[model samples]
Structures are given as C-alpha cells and as structure tokens.
Target: MSRRVVVTGLGGICATGANVPEFWDNSKKAVCGVSVRTLKAGDEYSITLPIAPIDGFEDRLAEFGRDMARADRFTQLAIAAADEAVRDAGVDFASGLGRRTAAIVGTGIGGQTTFDAAYLAMLKHGRKPHPLSILKIIPNAPASHMSIRYGLNGPAFAISSACASGAHAIGVAADMIRSGAADAALAGASEALLTYGAMETWKAMHIMSDELCRPFSKNRKGLIIGEGAGVLVLEDFAAAKKRGAKIYAELAGFGMNADGKDMINPAVEGAAGAMKTALSTVGAFDPAGVYINAHGTGTLLNDPTESKAIRDVFAAGADSLVVSSTKSMHGHLLGAAGAIEAIATLKAMETGVVPPTINYDEPDPACDLDYCPNEAREQRIDLALSNSFAFGGLNAVLAFRRV
Candidate 1:
C-alpha cells in the first residue's frame, strides 16, 4: 500500500517568537519584529539597516549543551527548534525509531556568522581561524548535528536552494517516508545570516528595505532579513495514527520547479506551474476554504508576479481565497522562510485565523488580493499552501490539508 505522510509535530523560532506557540501568537497579533539595528565588524566596518533579529536568545544556548554551544548559530538554532519538535511528537528514539528516522535540514547560507568571525580573525586581526571552522561553516552542519543529536540513522543531508531550501527539504523527507525509505523524519531549515559581513553584502545588492516589509502594497520597499529556524516531525500517517500522536496536518502535496529564466527576477509562469502541480496531487478543493501563505518578499518584482501567478492558478476563485505574508511580522528568514511559513500555515488551519500582512499602507492594483490586511481574520481553512520562491528562479509550493 502507498504510504501517506502526516505532520506529527511543529517547532519554530524567529524574531517574532522563540518557539511555535509564541510565533503563532505574535503572528496573530500582527506584531512587527522589524527594527533598525547596527552591525559592525572589527570596529571599522558597520552597516545600519532594518532587521528582525532575536534578542535574549543567548541565555538559552547553554541549555543545548557543549556540542551545540560550539556549533554555529545556524546549527544551534536548528537544534533548538528540533528539540521542541521531538518533544512535542513524543517520539522515543530509543525504541527502534531512531534507526528509521531521517534528518534533512536545509540552509541557504550556512554558518555566515561563524564565517564572518573566522575571516575577521584571520584577515583583519592577523590571527589563525578556529580549528573547527570548517565543520561549523559547512552547509551540512545542521543535518549532521541532528543525526548525532537525535540518533537518527536514516538518510541525512542538507539542501541548499537559496530560499526554497526549507520547503525542498520537507518535501524530500516526505517523499522518503512515502517511498518506504524511512518511517519518520526530522525536516526543515535554519538560517543565521544576520551578521555584519552578511548584511553588508545584502546591502550592496540594494534590495533590502530601509524600514518595514510591506508585501503587496504600493509603498512596499523590500525584504528585511531575519534569522532563526523551523522544524517539523513527519511520520507515516498509519504509524502516527497507530501511535496515537497528535497530528497537526497531512502532508498532502508538494511541487517544485525552476524558472530557468533569471537569477533574480521571479517568473509568473514558474510560480503558477508549481501551484498547479501541487494542487494536482490535492485532487480538488474549495477555493473559499483555502489559505495561502504567500512568498511575498515585499520586493518590487516578486509581489506582482506572485499575484499574477495566484490568479493564474486559482482563476476566478483566486479572489475568494485569503492570502497573507507573515514575513510582514517576522521578516524574511531566507532559507528557513518556507519552514516557519509552513508552521504559520498549519497554525492558520488549526485556529481558523489567518495572520495579517502588516505594514500595508497602500494597495497596488497589480497585486490585488485579499491579503487579510493589518488585522487577523477568522475564516474556515480546510487547505493551506505555503509558497517559497528563491533566487535563481527556484520555486517550491507545499499543500496541506486538515487531518
């Protein structure tokens, strides 16, 4: 028999919240986490920009133990979130499940903070870099850490597709379970690129917002970078049911495609095709009961192009469904954007409250849709879609249904 995958647990940490419940609560309140901050390197190089960064998280780092203490910020964040997921799922790895669990974590730019510190020490301070710098800076650090941390012995690796990394990791893990490669998996993504050097590079692109991220708005500037991690515990539906686990939602469908057009510019056809392909696995659905967690980066080109894609996929029903960008509250997490957004989508389905797209002062006709606006809205949501469109024209859409 063909297997089905279900989300048995969800965990997330971001600027808006330190964990899933907190994140969802802050999101529902439309609390904006974006603020002006200054980052410096070697006292000479510094950049001031609006960023959504977590504060007071350092106090909790020691609780993760020595290995995590020595790991990069990105991997540490992943462990923080994954710990919560495993606890929530009530999974005992000691009971033979560890041998069948896969750990698939993704990151767009891994260990940016560590890399910056190492480079600063070696180049600017005329000192040797950390001996374990390579291990911490590797993109697979999170995946490897999770495997050792949780005793997972199945397929473990990292996927780096820029912003789509999270969704791609989750999708691939689900496929693995469905194909009988694994019985359970820890999947998601983490990103910690809020360093001085990283911010300077992003600033050089001139695509970052000066103030707030206002997606689908006429006065939108651009995306504000944030750092954190989100993770999910996925298990074969039958096993989850047999174990009496509290299922959050069903991993119904996943779609991924590349634009093959531009490195920066998003393609409308690519976005629409991905959504359509995801829906193909969904069979059919009521448009009014759908909620889309948009990949609304609040950028000039992405907003309208994604709007058109939604219109293309849903056609007349596009106007009926509600869509919102929680990035307006939590800021863009780059690779981990899809993972936390998927958590947001699942929360919306669970609570029937669609989080708002905050900072929307003006609406653009080109990007016309029910964005929920600055206030959360109560609606019956039977289906949810989390969209992740990355640089290099990579797009991933995940569809979930109430289980």
Candidate 2:
C-alpha cells in the first residue's frame, strides 16, 4: 500500500478566528485580534499588557461532553478543533478507521492554568491542590483525551518542542502514515498558556511586545502571547482519494533539525537547512508561486535571522516569493503557532490569496523580503511552506502543494 499523506480537513481556534473559515476570512481582511487585557493571579498580583485571547470559548464547553469539560483548557481547545476537523473530513472512525488512526497532539506548556492554580492555592491560600491536578497538568492530557474521545487505538502521544511543537506533531504524524505505522492521523497542537504565571514568566524574559507584533519591521518590538488550538485531519492519500475525500493539499515534505548552539538564539544555518531539506521532496517549483508562512516572531533577533535564512534557501529567487507572518494578526500561539500557520499556508494556497503581515510600519534593510505588507495579496500559489523555529533552536518546516 502506498502511504502518501494529505491534509483532508483543517480546524483552528485562536484570537483571530474561531474556526478555519473564519480564520481564513479574517486573514484575508487583515484583521488584528490582539488587544490589551489584564491578567491577574490574585488580588495582589496583576499585569496589564497586550494579548490575543479567545474570549467566550467557555460557553462552548458543553458541546465537548463532560470529559473535555473536566480536562484542562488546552485539552478542551484541542477537542473543539478536533471535532471540527473530524466533521469537516467526514471520516467515520466507527467504521474501523479509529483503530488505524493516530492522535498526536502537541503543547509547549501543558495545562498551564491548572499548574498556576495549583501552585497559587498551595502557596498562598494554604490549600491542597486538586487530586486531578497531576492528570490535568500532564503534557499528554490532550493526546490521551483525544484518543479516548475519538476511540483511536493507534499511536497516541504529545510532542513538546516549545514553539515548534505543532509543526513537529503534524510532521511526525504524517511521517507515521507514510511509514505504514498508521493509515490516518489527527495531527495538530493546542496551547492555553495565557495564564498569569505563564504570562509573568514570558514577561520576565523581556521578549513580549506591549503593543503590536510588527514582523520584519525596523521598529518591531517583540511577540505577543496568544492562546488557541489548531487541528488537521491527515489521511493516506490513496485512501482519501479512493473515498472521494475533500483533499486540501498533499503533505509533500517535512524537515526538522536542532541548531544545538544556543537555546535562545535562532541560527540561520539550521533554518535554511531545514527549508532546503523540505524543498528537496517538492521537486522543481517556481519561487513566484511559493508562499512562505514565516516564523517571523517580531522579536529583536528572529525577523532578520529568518529573512537571511529564507534568502539563503531561495537565493536570487527570494524576491520572487511572498512571505508573511500571520502572527502579526493572530498573535503568536506558541505551541499552536505552526499548526495554525500551516492552516493559513494551506488556505492561502487553496484560495490564492496570501495573508498579510499586518502592523508593518517600517521595513528593516536586513529584512527586505516582500512580506505582502499590511494588505493581503492575490496570486496563484503552487506551493506553500510553514516555518516554525522554537526558542531552543528547534526548527521544523512543512511543505504542501495542491493535489
């Protein structure tokens, strides 16, 4: 059996959009979901800053059943996204597909809200943590919940690679399908780390923007934290085609590597190498038709580094390609960044309208690539790549092409 992989459905929820269609629509409109909000750990501790938060998501918890409601917010978000993906793919797991499907969800910081509450309660309130705190705080909670929820009996687990977690999970799931380890997979990531403790920790690093995320801009401040989940239903290409599935795009290539140099600094060499490796399987492609969903974190070090990497990979043709950071609109989803960005990439390819890198006030000389500026561009897209580079120099790139 040939084990080629394809993305049949995409589901996502974020500060930008509640689902894939909404996300794509908002992307085309260049809608910015980031806003100023106050997060408080207790009465004594509070911080106000710009954040991309998905408000009113709690109202939808009843639809996920009791188990998901009891799970952490990350798990809930994952289930919500997965529900949409499974429906959109029209896959009937009850018809023996569940046994051969894998649930591979990723999270950079699992159950952060639960962890924060537990510590705060124990330290300040003189109270014991909940008995289910261990289970809730486990990184694999979302994966396990998904497996049980979907009745999946194949390989089920979670990947934690900081910001690269989503891309790593999706790529690994596709690889498993290609290797005959599974026939299909629920592949994506979820993150709900906008809790007070997580925010404080991120603020301590001095890498968060107080206002907007302006990627590739000369006056770029830093990334803003966001919370949400993005899920994709991936299946074997042969099987999906045989069943007349609505194929979004073929999962053509994946490349991952660790820089091994510094935890904080991203290396241009590692990023360029991964991108090259991913393109290795893509055959010959026109740079003009390529759309790169860049890992443009809008930070002091990331924008220029990523620009140089893209230029190194594409060389003279770099100017022909269009690159954008949807993070400028949705804010950085941390672990969920790659999954949603992959969706954005696929949507751009499918619709032939590239999302804009919004909030781009000033351009930097070092980052001279065409970012599509503050407005979305309409162009034919034959290939798309979603770039994800984590804080630990973990790099993952995914390539997709129309089938």
Worst 10 residues of 1 by lDDT: 276-285
lDDT of 2: 0.93
TM-score, per-candidate, Cα-based: 0.99, 0.99
lDDT of 1 at 177: 97
The all-Cα superposition gives candidate 2 an RMSD in Å to the true structure of 0.9
Q: What is the C-alpha lDDT profile of model 2 across 202-310, one tens digit per residue?
A: 9999999989999999999999989899999999998999999999999899999999999999999999999998998988898999999999999999999999999
Candidate 1 per-residue lDDT, tens place, 1-403, comes to 4698999988899999999999999999999999999998989998889999989889999899999989999999999999999998998887999999999999999999889999999898999999999999999999999999989999999999999999999999999999999999999999999999999889889899999999999999999999899999999999999999999899899999999999999999999999988888876789999999999999999999999999999999998999999999999999999999999999999899999999998989999999999999999899999999999999999999888
Prediction RMSDs, each to the true structure:
0.7, 0.9
Residue 333's lDDT within candidate 1 is 96
Error of 1 at 255 (Å): 0.3
Q: Residue 352's C-alpha lDDT in candidate 1?
A: 93
Which window of 10 residues has the lowest lDDT sum in candidate 2?
Answer: 1-10
